[model samples]
Target: MPFKTEEMLLNVGPQHPSTHGVLHLEVTTDGELVTNAEPTIGYLHRCFEKYAETLTYQQIIPYTDRLDYLSSMNNNFGFVVAVEKLMGISVCERAERIRVIMAELNRIASHLMFIGSFSNDLGAMTPFLWCFRDREEILKIFEEVSGARLLYNYYRIGGLAADLTPGIEDRIHSFLNQFEAHMLELDDLFTRNAIVIARLKGVGMIPRETAIAYGLSGPMLRASGVDWDCRRDEPYSIYPSLRFEVPVGGEKLGALGDCYARYLVRRAEIDQSVSLVRQCLTDIPPGDVKEQVKRNVRPPVGEVYVRTENPRGEIGFYLRSDGSTKPSRVKVRAPSFCNMSVFNRISKDILVADMIAILGSVDIVLGEIDR
Candidate 1:
């Protein structure tokens, strides 16, 4: 006689460690294999869009910081750029370079967190520590520049809140010199480990078409061999002049668009970001960091949509101005929110253990998803 089988419905979390945040996954499984996965969000929703409409343009900067707390500087960059476009304000060259440097540094820090947490989710603890150890250096630099370690409301409508502090570039260069060697060490320790390879390789594959259909962005979209990056294609702020490679998942490591592929893409992006930072340091010009603008920013009656390449993906802000101090409408195109839409599609027919690997690879920030 054939063995009897039964399907079980499993609730992964509103509090589970593997879910990454306050996200609930209603996963249906047959023994160890997951047959279906439905991600239930909104536990952390703060009505971010509604709040933006009520606050003045400057006031909303701090709230954007809360959306993707890991990449707060990028969030600030996207919002300010949008408001600047609406107001027709021109940012100084020096401020543009400063914003790019800060945003890229935040990208590196955010990816480092992903690396650490993803490794922890896969059952290895050592890489997690190593990732955080390196990430701390970046965070310290942020603190020095912004005076806040986490939610930095450092970007203004026309430019930055302040210029880069003296000697900060030297500190950044020193960190970059050390970070490259440490990255190689991390690769040897975890990226090539047999256990990690077995868990990640050929698992949770998302095809290029599916990724595009779902509007996935950032590393998730690139890892699927899409070869699209808003920074490169869209050309926002100083990104037009910067030179860096957009890493994509190819057949070299366990087929394209797999969990392992995403991991490799993120690791490679860290290197590219390091290179971008060096270019910013070498070419950064001296000029007025902030443009002269009215204290109460009242953009002329119009609407504008601006997108920036954030650490997670493309962060866009749509603003409708009615010649008021406050925006008439504010809508944020959050990358985490869009990326999470593909979870149910990709998680189908994978092992429950593999589901964890897939979720880690997706790297959703619940704050942004639930917003």
Candidate 2:
């Protein structure tokens, strides 16, 4: 006689480590295989958009820091650009270079967190330690310039909160020199491990078309072989002046658009971010970093939508001003929320263990999703 089977429901977390944040994965399973996995968000409900209306333009800067706490600098970059566009204010050359440098450094820091956390999710504890060790170097640099390590509300509507601190570039260059060698060590220890390959290769595959239809972005989109990046395609700030490669997944890395592809793509982006930071450091000009503007200057009655590339993906802000210091309307196009929409589609009929792998690969930060 054939074996009997029964279906069951499993909750991955609103508190579990595998869920990455305050996210719940409702997984329906038949024995060990997951039939479907649906994500339940909103454990951290930060009403950033609603609050934007109540607060002045400058006050909203600190709030954006909470959206994707990992990519706070990039979040600041996107919002300030939107306000600047609405006001028709162009920042100085020095400030623009500094903006790109800070944003790219944050990108590196964010990816390091992803590497560390993703490794921890997969049961490899040492790579997680190694990642955090190197990541601390970047955080030190951020703290020196912005005066805070994680949530640096350092970008401004017209320029930056402050100019780059003296000798910061030398410190960054020193970190980059060591970080490159360290990444190769990480590659040997984690990326090429036989056990990791068996666990991730050919698992949770999303075809290029499906990724596009589902509106994925950042590493999620690029890993599926999409040649799109908001920084390069939609140039903003000093990104047009920077040179870097957009990494994509394919046969060279592993199976196209699989869980492994997502991992590999993010790994490659770290190198590109390092290069971007170096370029900004090399040619940064001298000028007043801040453009003189009122502390509560009002924008002309207008609406503008601006998108910038964050470490997670494209972060766009829609700002409508009624000639007031506070915006009348503010909406965010959060990349993680868009990327999470496709999870259930690819997650069906995989092993429950594989579901965990897929979720880690998604790298969802619940703060942004719930916000």
Candidate 3:
């Protein structure tokens, strides 16, 4: 006679600590194994797209900041670039380099948060504190440049709101030097820890085909052995001039598409971002940060779609203009939203603990998902 067990339903909260931010996971379990996992969102919905339609193109930048609150600079970059494309305006050379520097710094900062939070979810508390320590340094730089730490409305339609604040470049160079050493310490502390390796390796494996079908991007897609990166594949702004390798995951640290692979990809990206920032610093030309963009900020009656490589993944903006100062329609292709959709599929048949590992690996920010 076979052993009999009953399935159980568990709600992992729109309030659970590990759900990250106001996300609820309706999980079905058979003993310790998860039978299915369904993500329930909308707890933090601010209707950013709707707000964008009502506000001026310049005003919509702050709304984007809330979408991926961790990667506000990249969010600002994507929206401004889309509007600039629609208006046929080119930002000055210095502005382009500054944008790249800020975006890459934000990328490192965002990944640091992921490193901390993901490790904490796995029950290692040390990494969480260490990662935050490094992240705070990046936030300080942001605060100095933009006058706000979290929601930086720094990027304008044609250029940045202002050039890098005085002594900001020196501060950035100093931070980078310190951050590089800390990254190595992080690798030793968590990446190679035997227990962490065992927990992450061979868990929550999403095949390359499945990942692509689900529209996974960033480290999630790359962890499944995909070589596509928006920064390299779809060159924009000053990215084409910069030198950096896009990290792809495949048998480097365990099986392809496992939680470990995803973690490794993000780990590698921090190094790449550092390199990009260094390049931007060395090659940044001097010119007026703000271009001769029209004050009214009205675009021709047309639509434009722009995508950029955010820390989470590809953040896309679709803007439709009706010859008005405000966007007629604004639709955001948030990476966290697309990445989260694949959770239920990958979480099926995994252990409850493994489900957490998978969730952490995906790195979904509820702000972007519910926006």
Q: Please, what is the whole-model Cα lDDT of each candidate in the order they appear?
A: 0.90, 0.89, 0.90
Candidate 3 off by > 4 Å: 1-4
Candidate 1, which segments miss by more than 4 Å at Cα?
Answer: 1-3, 252-254
For residues 1-371, write the lDDT of model 3, one tens digit per residue: 99988999999988988899899999999889899999999999888888888888887888888899999999999988888889888888899999999999999989999999999999999999999998999999999988898889889888888888877888899989998999899889999999999999999889999999999999999999999999999988978888899888885645799999999999999999999898888846778887477666999999998999999999998889999898899999999999999899888888898898889889988989999
Candidate 3 lands at a TM-score of 0.98
In model 2, the Cα lDDT at residue 274 comes to 92
Candidate 2's C-alpha runs over 4 A off are none
lDDT of 2 by residue, 185-283 (tens): 999999999988899998889899999998889999998989899899988887887788889898676779998889999999999989998888986
What is the C-alpha RMSD, rounded to one decimal, of candidate 1?
Answer: 1.3
- TM-score of each prediction: 0.97, 0.98, 0.98
Deviation (Å) of 7 in candidate 1: 1.6
Q: How accurate is candidate 2 locally (lDDT)?
A: 0.89
Clashing pairs in 3: none
Error of 3 at 152 (Å): 0.8
lDDT of 1 at 83: 90
